[model samples]
Target: MRYNIIHRTTYKYESPVTVGHYMARLEPRTLPFQECPWHELTIFPSPIERAERSDYFGNTNVYFEIEGSHQKLEVIARSLVEVIRAQPFDPASTPPWETIRDSCRSDVYNPATPAGELTFASTLIPVGVPYADYARPSFLPGRPILQGVCDLNRRIHRDFVFDPKATDAATPVEKVLKQRRGVCQDFAQVMIACLRSLGLPARYVSGYLETVPPPGVVKLVGADASHAWVSVYCGEVCGWMDADPTNDVLPSERHITVAWGRDFADVSPLRGVTTGAGEQRLKVAVDVLPDKD
Candidate 1:
């Protein structure tokens, strides 16, 4: 499937003046599951200086400085990508929960992968056990599996919610687990913290979700926004399996990768700091459209 994405983020300030710098991670990368043939980003009221580099996590970073006195700013990113992903339905060959846990230890790392760092502590996912002794799906009849890390990707999906306002970027895992509401980022973080707590490693992913409406229903422009998820290492044979806890499904052709890192802070689409502003307001609009024939 091919898609054309247009994302516009506008900031309207009550008062604006002086210097500002921003970090942007809006470009998509070609991974095993998707192909990004073309991608571009444009900023209105262009900045005075711009620099681009790859972060330690292998995510492309764009840093720019804008110096002036303006009350409004708008940044737009557009891209066209062709995605091809495969679905593997066999579950019997899936490793048992214990084996997956044992494989993920604090010392495993894949230098070849973009992140350049891979280990069990980084991959182990966290889970929240309402009761410390409850029986988990991947655990023995009487024992409990750790809170975040699940043996299989399918289990992660079944145990989370996709509430946009459940938590903000600053919310902690303990709080999110207590509220039981959060966006994909929250779920991914909880999973990461759990994995790390158990001496495993995990990483966060940011991307887009291809939404298909029911038959005869018109697709709304900008209705589909960017998405977030996580990945955990399960030994060399199983490798890193991507899981979307928000949607409760494994990644398929419907998913597109933009960037990845330890957490959302490392790969936010847009982040910046400004001096000399009493207050500010922000508005965002995103459109993921199928390419025209």
Candidate 2:
């Protein structure tokens, strides 16, 4: 499947006087099952300095600074990407949850390896007995790691309500667990916290999930939104696999992966520090349309 994604972010400040610096992680990643042929970032009130680099997790990151001031700031990211469905596998065939958990816990201090790096708690998600207990039902003794993950994913989808008003980006996972409501970010983080609490390796994936309109209804231009999911390492042979608790499905061709890390902070689409800009209003519009031709 091919897609044309446009992500637009606007910030309107009550007062703007000086400079602004920002970093954006909006480019889609190129994985074995994904390829981004073209991507571009357009910033209004053109930045004085701009550069691109790869972050530690290998996501494409852009940095820019605006020397002069403006009350309104706009940054638009556009990309064309192709994604293929990942090969299907039997979750029950994978290693037991205990085996993977033990292997990761033994050498978790070594952040050099990707799996090891994610096995511990991070800024947003915490590991604790509560999270582990929440996950225990799905991870019975000798249960396959992927099997348990899929069960956990399904449980979250069934248990929680997707209420945007219930939580924000800074909402804690523990709170979300108690409230049983939040957007995709909360669901993904809660799952990560649950897995990490059990000494399992899991990472947060930030990306786009295609949304389809009703059969007779026209698709709105900016109806889609940024999405988040979870990926678990099921030992070496099976490698890392993705699960979307928000939708109760494994990520596939419709999922466009951007960047992933231990949590959302590491791969926020756009983040910046502004001088002299107080009382800001943020508006984000995202479009994930199927590419023609």
TM-score for each predicted model, relative to the true structure: 0.82, 0.97
Best by lDDT: 2
For model 2, residues 1-293, the per-residue Cα lDDT tens digits are: 99999999999999984899999999999999999999989999999999999999999999999987699999999999999976867998998999887776675553325577688899999999999999999999999999999999999999999999999888999999999999999999999999998889899999999998889999988889999999999888878899999999999899999999999999999999989988999999999999999
What do the candidate models score in CA lDDT, each in turn? 0.68, 0.92
Candidate 1 lDDT over residue span 1-293, tens digit each: 89898888888778874778889898888777677788787886699999999998778888988899887778898888888876653444544545545545325644324222433223223344431222243445322222233442344455656677777767776777667678877777766665544434467899888788899999887788778887765445555667777776777777888998777777889998887756888788888887886
Best by TM-score: 2
Candidate 2 structure lDDT: 0.92
Model 2 lDDT-worst window of ten = 105-114
Q: What's the lDDT for candidate 1?
A: 0.68
lDDT of 1 at 199: 33
